[model samples]
Target: MVSLIIFSILSLDTILNVPELKNAHYGICFLDLKNDSIIYDYNSEKLFVPASNMKIITTAASFYFLGKEFRYKTNFYLRGTIKDRKLYGDIILQGGGDPYFNLENLERFADKIISMGINEITGGLLIIDDYFTDERLPAGWSWHYLDAKYAPEISALSFNKNVVSVRMRPTNAGELANVYIYPSTGYVKLINRMTTTTNSENIIIYRKPEENTIIVDGMINIKNARDIDVAVKDPAMFAGEYLKERLNARNIKVSNPVARIRTYELFLRQKQPVLIDSVLSPNLLEIIKETNTESENLYAEILLKTLGAYRYKEGSFNAGLNAVKEFLNICRVDTQNISLWDGSGLSKHNLISPAVLIAVLKFIYNSNLYYDFYNSLPQPGKGTLKARFNGFSDTLRAKTGALQASSCLSGYIKINGQDYAFSMLFNNFVCPIKKIMQIQERIIRAFYEEMRRTNVDNTELLKPVEVIQQ
Candidate 1:
């Protein structure tokens, strides 16, 4: 049995010792959850960039700290009394850090306003977005990727995930492509320089820094229509503009433009605001599922800030980091082995060892929310794990992370009815991402085969024989 275990460890080593990964910094840890023992480990103590795999940590901590039934509430308040279908005071929209707030919700708010017998407002729409600090971007984020949909600015008042979809359809060859923006608002200006080509499509969309002008350049094949999601500059302002538009569409006239005020300013008013209605976001479990399975950077960041706001009455990144560290301490994970700069792994500064990830997984597994956390991860043929672990769909579940020169996969794998937690962290690799994924798949397959070959009587063989690397 001991020799068989040794052979399995040697086999994994052989699989990892490939030329493509020769220059890469990588770590692996596989633990038998039933036995509470490390089955195999190589460089598991060394820290490496985790990319979106950091969502795993953020989601787990959120599930533990914020109950599964937690929901964000965005409130609507009326500052003055209504008379003859006219509201003399402002209608305040108090943001509650709802990351999933969207245009549909805006419509609902409009309907609520109409139901309140208020058809006209004498004052402007006041937006209270001070639930979170004004730090829109997280620390250590790559500035060059700010225009991307995945790197949108964070805000307490977010609408449509703080992004807009630019759709381009090819026209006659050599002609510029037809451009359209979703929601069709006048909030952004589009500069289209994209031409229709006879060859493959190559489209580049960029939003000017601190501005709403988007430049759409490159070429699109005549047969393809491309839809690119670009991040917005000021998310609160974007939401405000759309809300104002929606109100006008509903025939609710506003005397002034939409205005923003801090929470303190709202409280300083002589006449207190009257709560009219509120919109509630989906429960936290649903949000966590989306955050982990979709690898949503915005949702993770919002969850982080929410923790800070809930625990310390502050919603800054520093407060969020402190909250995450406190949660890690609660899980008994060693703080020295981890460096987390942001909740989303979009920041390149995040570093964690495979052993630390395994520790987090183990802690969640033993907790009451284990099943909730487990089901939140992506599985084979689903979410980020789509097209992965082809033959083990029912037995394998994981989260994948990828960035320039970094790739990682971590989660649970069941073999012969026994569950195991595993993490594979690879960073600074010069090889193509496809090559790294292939290596990871091969290693997982090798371990699966080895574990399947062992019988119930040989279950002890799955226990730790030795640590392959310190």
Candidate 2:
């Protein structure tokens, strides 16, 4: 059992010197908010894989480039005239890169069409998805994660975050397990070879690349139910099919199947489209809140592309990365030490120093968007910190990130009614992640306990104590 001495002083240096962190490549920086002073630092200039901590940078850049009130607008248009309650023109669904577009929004669009007294559409549904590049996946993403819900395909037109849930229920031993897909859409086909077994559960779900054929093969115990969320192969087509279904469900007769085209092809048709209705996404601030609070990969990626679309008129990964770089320059970050490959730190290619993250947090703290950005981070017992920092609720707000062997926590912590920004990143550690997390918490607790002692001198509190490693 581990023993602790209450009177013994603790600091970041002492906490990290233990055997638990001997093999980890890590960096840390703690900055006092009031004086903009560096209270403590260890390997702060070294580059490390940031994991979801990269969202801090993405969130800052998004607020800088796309204001708090920015919203994605998806418009519907009619290319043909309506006569005798029958529309003779095609209904165009133009995508505006709305990441939150869902079935409810589609239903609203259908209802709006019905309100226009249009029962029949003589032309096919034209889906315009050229606002972003055709590349669905970003660079440096692992091939193994392509089918995961967290790594869903990015598209200008997305439905339900481009993922579908597959629920598997076990019956009896030696029998096939029952499988059900959510949204009840025929967008993908599933081949279920899952068997109910008397032993422990061992299930595997795989979706073929660029294809909608998902294979469920494995054995599940009779006592358990497995639910897996798989990414869709094509987001734009998925949206088109789902939208068509929604329109048909509302008794709207669509004459032809949906066809997807780029802006160039639509302009060549020589027919001007008239606007009918549109859907607006939640503002940028709310989206960033979700992105940072939940460490959502899809939202971060969408915001990156949206930035690209706004700045360069090209919604591609390279353009979005360029926009982020520009924002970093404005923040006066040392870009030479950072290598950002994707908006979401799912890419192992993303390397950033703790000092860089401190720079971003400092910039946000001093900017006009400080409150909005600060409030976006999750407090203890909320979001990603839901299970962490018990009893430290209002005093701590942070972002947590983990990717395989990488782990990080960064944000603000209050001590004696004073707020301070800090970042702790650990990468390529052979030790169990739980141990690393405990060490991180210990470091935080050390700072909290040491700095909060009213009678202790500032210099004495900052002194590091020698820790004996087990």
Candidate 3:
């Protein structure tokens, strides 16, 4: 097993040890958790874009600052008085940076109002999105990603993940494809140029930059009802309109039906949105599960913003990023090589080294948060890695991240009851992304095989130590 590990590392060094890393960059690090010693290291300090793996840092910061049971609260306020079952005031939906606030919760809010016998609401629905300003979208996000579900607009009052569901299907085989935007509102305008075709389907969805217009022009195979979710221009508007639709369906008359989003401070220097009724998000532990396991970008980003709001009392992207940095420093993890941009790691500007990741893992392993943090990561054959690591599923627990030609996998591995943490990052790989993943899988298998032998040798006393320089 030890020979196999050496052969594996040598093999990986040859394959990954390319010329100057102009075409690709590989950062690898492995640690023996029990001994606090380096099992292997190859350019571990070299900086590389971390992609979604940055969620590890965000999640770690979250667990350290925001306890596992931390819950997000979005307050509902009736800004007006009720007269004989008639509301003479506005309905203010104050956002508390709830990332998972969905359409069902708004429906329940409407139900709660109707149950109070307020059949007629003679006021407008105002969504206070002041927790963060209009500059809610992160600075480094790509323009094209804004139209996709992966990168939604960041706001204090985000709803339905701040997405507009697109429903389309083939129409009569020759006519244009049928298209409709759900939660049907003027928040987004659709321009459909898609046509039914028998050829291979080539679908392309594009959003007008800085606008609420989307162009869905593509080819669809026959007889298919497909749904695609795209991020909306305004989350506050989306929430307001959807709530209005639900309330109207229940026969609650809204004399003013326009959806309004406000950036004004609720009352005090801080936004003092008075609570009337509210919805509490799932606890931070479960949220961290979704963020790491499913690689849910929205969950992680919201957790970052929530961290900012909780510690700094301001829920902006900058505030959250600064807070995360502060947490890393507190943990004694080196902050010099890390460049954190967005909490989700979707932004290309974020840079993190493999050694930095392992340092964080060491911190989590020694702390009381070991269990929750470990389980929060996607296990083999689970979560985002549901189809990954085919035979080694039970033995591997890790987080997978990718961005175009760049890919990464980082996490903990338990061999013969001895734990280890490792991070493998590849940047600017010219080959297919799957090829990089396959290489990662093989290297890990070697590590697993060799580590088992090392555990036995430790029990017997002398252990061989060899460091390979790339």
TM-scores for all candidates: the values are 0.94, 0.93, 0.91
Ranking by TM-score: 1, 2, 3
Candidate 1 differs from the real structure by a C-alpha RMSD in angstroms, to one decimal, of 2.9
Q: Rate the local accuracy (lDDT) of all candidates.
A: 0.88, 0.86, 0.82
Candidate 1 global lDDT: 0.88
Q: Is candidate 1 or candidate 3 better by TM-score?
A: 1
Evaluate model 3: give its TM-score.
Answer: 0.91
Which 10 consecutive positions of candidate 1 have the poorest summed lDDT?
A: 1-10
Off by over 4 Å in 1: 1-8, 456-470
Better of 1 and 3 by lDDT: 1
Clashing pairs for model 2 are: 80-89
* Distance from true location, Cα of 400 in model 1, Å: 0.7
Clashing pairs in 1: none
